[model samples]
Target: MDWEVHQNPERLVKTFPFANFREALAFAHRVGELAEAKGHHPRLTVEWGRVTVEWWTHSAGGITEKDREMARLTDLLLG
Candidate 1:
């Protein structure tokens, strides 16, 4: 997993579409579980039919491997 692969200007940003808010929230919950398990959390934004996830090591002021790993797992959940 490489955080550099995600090209958002703010950094560590990934977005996905869902059928509805319910699905988006469900996916967010799954992300929450993973974050808790690994002790790494992300900033999440849920809209009508989409979710935007941002992950970065705040203390370090940049993205890290953990963010990429979580992004992959989040993609898996969406799949």
Candidate 2:
């Protein structure tokens, strides 16, 4: 229901589940395209039935509104 916040290097992470690898991979690709368009990329781990996305701001030195917005946009990808 919410993102997993990480410490050390601050980040907002979430996991999207799917029935198969193709679905997850497709979702990851969409995120990649979105990242390219926004010029803000996240760490994406595409597995057999899920994709984990982590967003954070490097220049800002922490999690910022941009990271949250990217996570929001990522949710929009499903809608």
**Per-prediction TM-score, please?**
0.81, 0.94
Query: Which runs in model 1 stand beyond 4 Å of their true positions?
Result: 1-10
lDDT of 2 by residue, 1-79 (tens): 3889998799999999999999999999999999999999999999999999999999987799999999999999987
Q: Name the lDDT value of residue 6 in candidate 2.
A: 94
Q: Which model scores highest in TM-score?
A: 2
The positional error of residue 78 in candidate 1, measured at the CA in angstroms, is 1.9
Residue pairs with backbone overlap in model 1? none
Which sections of candidate 2 miss by over 4 Å? none
